[model samples]
Target: MSGWTWADVDVAVPRPGSGLPGVAMAGFRQRVRGDVEIAMVAHPSVTLFLDLSETGGIVREAGGTSRRGSFVAGLLPGRLRTGGQEGSGLQIRLSPAVASVVLGAAAELTGTVATLEEVWGRDAGRLEERLRDAPTWDERFTIATDVLARRLAVPSRVEPEVAQAWRRTQAARGRLRIDGLAEEVGWSRQRLWSRFRAQLGLTPKRAAQLVRFDHAAHLLAAGHPPAAVAGRSGYADQSHLHRQARAITGLTPAALATAPWLAIDTVAWLAAPRT
Candidate 1:
């Protein structure tokens, strides 16, 4: 819990095992120097637009996926099995700073799923332009970082103690107790939960659930057996692990095992906890 430092910040490719569903990497594609790629993606549970930039209005459909060709800024978590017309822009991965800057101060941003309609509601074209035509990747990242940082009333409101406790539990295979973490912070459970929810959106225990599941996915992707993965990833058993996977991702472990890209960002996000 020292202040935020570069040592605490990191960017990583998606970890294959985190059981959360959908993709981990966020990408932007440009055909020319500035051509935008926008499309609608249909998942089993949700249908959303993968609007990368807002311009030139050339709509194309690839397979079941439709490319509406708009602009994009922030993308939420979900299964992305569809694609828009390919573009040339680099899809840069974000650090926690970037997530925090773009997402505001919601510790757990679940429940509210992000989709194409949501982007259109916010008029994402402006930000999409910035991401597409920005002179450098750093420039786009910085702008995104600044936007979220400014939107959230308190950027560092997420308690380091809470995150640290969650991190410790994750490192220990989700065996850390909430009471132990509360004592370390010198606060009662009620107080800690309040602060944790307000700052990060989810309670410490729920955060631990996310961490545990993320680890489960990573282990599974690494070729561990289901029983072994369940035990190591903090599940009660194979059934327990299967239930959690379905609840979070709408996909069974068997389906996910074959999907290398599934829940790719969930692992990256949890492993870092930067935002």
Candidate 2:
């Protein structure tokens, strides 16, 4: 059996066609794992993350943080580093509409640190603790929503071009081809990649890979063979899937498959709009 330790609850509602969007729920504890390395998590949506105090990383509002045995940096758009496994919290997935506005506003944020005193009504550490202790999901979401609302006073003005492109990407369901995606978006490859990086923390290719990896992980957990998972997830083949899995998560498919703590709850409440 895999010795890795991790657990998570997906409270967000599943999007039609796409299983989950605009948010993701997760919790993990790296007891004996190697420094719990997580590949850069990049998505089109602006991610509002709550890192419980057990986590610690230097955050560059744009670059990213590398600390502890693990490294988590706030890539483009927005990110929160409240700190480790003890720092379990929610990741508020930002729709492109929400992302545009917040990114614009955050461009003017004074310092490197993600400020919370004024907007969140308190600091991140305390908020993390509060959420952890909250008796019910509703109470936790309420606090989460309150924090976002206060910081994002203005809702995003939707960008049809970007939004449509994002939809098309989703339609491909993690099996998107970067070259085709760029063409479909009507932008040159370089331009699309640049825009994707600016708006989201990852290049289009990286994002797709993550989606595929996540899918494969889920499939493996469901008892699918690596070869089948690879084919289903649009990988070149089983070998490709194995390499990608190790590259992205620092764990092999078989390793993750047998891990004792990989089971994560997939529930809608986890995705409910933050309070």
Candidate 3:
């Protein structure tokens, strides 16, 4: 076995035509000769991490709790960290809208980390076993996608209006007003606020902020200046962007620009075809 490095890790994604809407899957494997640690930033999606390693599997910590091996991380899992002596897994990112239907408890998962068994019970173990026995990353992706597709076939509990609101928010890059979303969705402000929070685990305003911050973080990672990123990301100004960045990631703009976590996005996410 060789030392672990992001560059040496094998990364795999599903075939382009096989994708489910609002869902993305990636498979990773590497030999670890020493300890490994990664600071994971918050993203807008609910994430499922399946650790397939037979020994020294990944351990995740957030919100004063720790989970080892496979787990589910909801949106805005603040200041999350993962460390271990082994690294091999399938990671699935599900949009909150789809997560509501698939996980069937997206609201309960908000801002927290829960074991896969806690979410899926015995099924979690079965899925992990199947993935571990797979001969290739491609096979694992196929298996994972098949399982997700089956789960998605169940009737969605999320209202169409709420899903539409989320779509509009993403399309606008969080620049639109919550009241406007309510109006577009044919619901009153109060109604929309309550329902959206109940289903997605965050208020509309916070969702917008997360989306905007995500945009700014990527731009910062892309070598843009903080002022330019803030303006481009719809922030009131650089100061506002700084505050939001600190609140979400606990890092200044300059420091965030070079974060190894965001840096990995270029290779593990952006480089892969969406599926």
Q: Pick the candidate with the highest TM-score.
A: 3
TM-score of each: 0.60, 0.59, 0.94
Q: Which model, 1 or 2, shows the larger lDDT?
A: 2
lDDT of each: 0.47, 0.50, 0.84
TM-score of 2: 0.59
lDDT of 3 by residue, 157-242 (tens): 78988889888888888899888899999999999999999989999999999888888899999999999998899998999999
lDDT of 1 at 63: 30
Candidate 3, pairs of clashing residues:
none
List, residue by residue over 129-170, the lDDT tens digit for candidate 2.
Answer: 777677665566666656545645775444455555566665
Task: Report the lDDT of model 1 for residue 196.
Answer: 64
Off by over 4 Å in 3: 1-5, 271-275
List model 1 lDDT by residue over 1-275, tens digit each.
12322122233333345312211333333333322222222111112223443443334433345445442322224433333333422232322223333444233433333333343355355556666676654565555444434554455544666555544654665557888888987889888878766654556676667667767766676667888988877678999999988876666777666443443334433433322
- Segments of candidate 1 deviating more than 4 angstroms: 1-50, 53-83, 88-102, 115-124, 135-155, 263-275
Deviation in Å, model 1, residue 213 alpha carbon: 0.7
**Any runs in candidate 2 off by more than 4 Å, and if so which?**
1-21, 24-135, 150-159, 260-262, 265-275
lDDT of 2: 0.50
Ranked by lDDT, the better of candidates 1 and 3 is 3
